[model samples]
Target: MRTGQQPSGHGFGSPGAAPRATNQNTVLGRAMGKVLAYIALTKPRVIELLLVATIPAMLMADRGNVDLWLVLSTLFGGWMGAASANSLNCVVDADIDKVMKRTAKRPLAREAVPTRNALVFGLALGLASFAWLWWRANLLAGVLVVITIAFYVLIYTMVLKRRTWQNVVWGGAAGCMPVLVGWAAVTGSLSWEPFVLFLIIFFWTPPHTWALAMRYKEDYKAAGVPMLPVIATEEHVTKQILFYSWAMVVTSLILVPAAGLVYAIVALLAGAWFLLLAHQLYRGVRGGAEVKPLKLFLQSNNYLSVLFVGLAIDSVLGLQTISEMFS
Candidate 1:
């Protein structure tokens, strides 16, 4: 059986050690792992919320006769654009991410993805988004998506996030772009309707993000990020949350004249509940009760989802025609 030397009985080779098996299951598992890693780099959960804001804005803009192709194109472009921005942010924040528990497992932080690879991926996605929107939607929408990516990457992530407590407040301007892009894609022009939507999202950002910051205050502090909850007292943070919650509710009502009676009723009821939750958060923090900031955070997410759902339903029902009463 042996030509040059006798084979070792230990393994399928005549070596000192057994050769590892490259079975189909192992090979497939590795491939799937890499695929999931890339997906995680996109932050799909965050993108879900952004798309939620986008489609509803488009529905409101078209009053429901939306061109399916346009919606699909905008969504694809938005996903690519947001992925590019978020991936780059992970690269830039990788250092701090290593120190923070919540983000410690991100691709860049875990070294699952190389920084060079992430950078290239981000740039490619950005370019692809621009081309997709420009070709499928329109020039204005494409340009707006580019601006949104730049604003989040340049203005917020690079400039504001680490420097001031006002980061989320002022930087929220980028998040408001979806409404603008949606409106422009449909009408090719700006108007009071979309701008009011922009303000509602702008005002909502602080409270929504601040509630999350409260839960991660220690992580932000240790990471040297000056999130409001990290730099301010709990009472101060909750009071600010309350203020912004009320402002968001008030700003949402401004859309009443553009959306209609159904929107008005939904906004009123949802706003009342939202404000109540914010008040409870404030009171709990003031009294040092056992309530978690996450309670407010969860309710805030629901509030937005409900409000947007109302918009979609109202658009289908043609209730926007009622808005002309005030207009």
Candidate 2:
């Protein structure tokens, strides 16, 4: 029942007997607890997808000869930047999160992290991320990340989330920036390639997020967040999902000309599979079948994972195809 203590009284045994050991363990535990609370603010699972999108773009930017040091540094900066934005969001939305099942256990929502402390932590992380990226990568990469944090925290979280049903659609621009950041980190400039990747993610976000909103529609309603599923009928939401799914698929194939036959083939196959799943979700919702939005939500994860992984693989192995097309 004691905070950070073993049930059998591991750190609590006769305080004066093993004072040194007890003090050390207690300090270590508290330090770790603080670290974890901060990490939770960043929403690690969301950052994983961002990194997944980021790394492949770096590889493709460098044609598979990406600098490992650059990748590691960019990832670190990206994590800090993302953590900063998510933390600020939690701080601002603490009240809303407290009422929602999905976000109620967040550090700020649960009052585990003080509002003032969380605000400082988020701001510090944002500043550090910019400095780290600028020092380790390129100025463009650093600036792009700053823009990402601004869009997510100021534009999306503060301005749009509670105000519009189209929040996720517009707000997803922040999430799509990782590819730009990663590409700029390597190439020090923007190109059509990274833009295509950005479009792919932009189109993909609606279905990805709306499916989740559907699963937690009531929670969003309770929180007063105007997510699509909360404001629109199930059929309308699904139709929008299908629309974005197809748009995402189409944008994904634009890389074919640049990425060559291997990437082209993988994109086609993956896009087809993703579209099929979207259609299935639409049909299920339309027919009033006992379908769970989580079904589509889970599939969206796999769809993205497969597509991003395929991109990485093609970047390394698609040289022959690239050479053949260009030769």
Candidate 3:
């Protein structure tokens, strides 16, 4: 009859109350941790870049009147698709990832999540993304999202990444899809504007990645991944990085004519600075200096962040000269 006493053989006020609460808390904590891990697996920084590329294409297509709903839908779809692709990459690269310092701690690589569970999660996300895009955005955007996922997961991860130094070159295709998705989400059709933006990102991937690869050449070699630095000499890779960085600057400038005068001026300044950083890397690589590649790698990260910010600024500002030039 006592409030804290158990009835018959039971020891507490409610049968298994304390144990159940403990279990519930444990489960809740685990669920929260898993959710955080899943979010991390989506690579928020990479998604930021993808979104940056997307918004400009949306603005250019709508000519300053981007559809808010469509943009939101496309963003959702893009994030899901990217998360799925990244998850698949983790699953597929588990073995190699374990060997590389850069990826050793990934959920799949470290067995923090079961491979089958990760695969299921990835597939479900991919399907949800497709459905979201088709229903809320447009079929074209949906299809492009699927293609991007397939390209990154199958073409790049399963095949090209292990076989050739040109992995990033071909792999870059997937990275460029958000622009197309953004364009289609706005206009329900593809156009030159998206294509130009796509090309800029496509060319930009190698140098941006190669600089990091140079810093991790030994790890890549140990893992037998055959990244550009692993496949080619330091001098060769550095020169290639410089070449691509220059090309990226030029390609970004193409938007000036298509995007506007504001875009052009921003592109010119950003591109020139990016190229200068690349040139410095080139000189260091030529001189057999290790610090140069790391410096360039960091600079490349800034280059992308700034370039996309500029695109978004131009989009919101609605500079007439740039719009007229593109128009």
Candidate 4:
């Protein structure tokens, strides 16, 4: 065999050895990076907040013994729908997201995931959510879920997000739908109590999100997004925040009689704390002080979580004294 010729290496040191090992490793790394990027597109933090609105509604509807199956189903469906909406938002805002530091690393903006792939993923999740909700929960709940998804994906993200300063004001209604969905899953119909909870979240969204927007005003301005702080003067934004903060407090307190003394006490304390923070932000904005709105933003999130948790607890406790008042 040609004098037992040494096998010729194809750009490698050994015969039959795999070539381009470095390139192969790079390709593997890139694939793994893309997978992680796709996960990030789901917006886990927003999903968590959405769950916050959902769980309390379920507990309140059940009045104590929440159906484990229903809870699980609602959670799965809500998460799927929320993730789908977030992905759609990313696709829609990819261009502007590239200009914002907070959103610059998003998968679509970073080109880690193809736009068509993201769109497909969102649609798949949304369809799965609808099917799950319809089969496991009431049709009303499923319908509400669909509406919530459409409101966020179409009305808020596509139509309003970049078009006006009041985007969050009106878009907030979309975020409040989880409460209605959860309540409908139990009752299979709409009622006043869940609507009250919806209103609480509707009013709460502004101050909670605006504080964050205030902190990121520069990024939003650079991206040409007309977020409240970007479009309105700081003083005006602060006033708006204060107004919504007061409204949230009032709405939350209304649930006291409709819910219970425990809920009332919790709402009172939480609402006071929320108002204090809002007042501080108002002062900071008025004085043109460089106060960190991030503090208020984070605290607002905690405040809402605690308030809702308290409501769930009160509902489970079932204070007859408080229930009779509504009767």
Which sections of candidate 2 miss by over 4 Å? 1-29, 318-327
**Model 3, 1-327: lDDT tens per residue?**
889965674566656577888899999999998887777666676777677788777877776565777777788888999998888887888899899998887787777788898889889999998999999887988999999999999999999999999999998899989999988988889878788889888888998889889889999999999898987888898788878887888888777765656677778888899888877777876777665577777777787777777777677677675546555
CA lDDT of each candidate? 0.86, 0.88, 0.82, 0.86
Clash count of each predicted structure: 0, 0, 2, 0
Candidate that beats the other on lDDT, 1 or 2, i.e. the better one: 2
Higher-scoring candidate on TM-score, 1 or 3:
1
1 or 3, which is superior by lDDT? 1
Root-mean-square deviation of each candidate, in angstroms?
3.9, 5.6, 3.8, 3.9
Q: Give per-residue CA lDDT, model 4, range 61-177, as digits (tens).
A: 888676888888898998888888888888888999899999888898889899999999988888888888888987888888889889998999888888998899998898899
TM-score of 4: 0.90
Candidate of highest TM-score? 1
Instruction: Single out the weakest 10-residue window by summed lDDT for candidate 2.
Output: 6-15
TM-score for candidate 2: 0.91
lDDT of each residue in 100-166, candidate 2, tens digit only: 9989899988887789999999999999999999999989999999999999999999999999998
The lDDT of model 4 is: 0.86
Off by over 4 Å in 4: 1-31, 321-327
**Model 1 Cα displacement at 290 (Å)?**
2.3
**TM-score, one value per model:** 0.91, 0.91, 0.89, 0.90
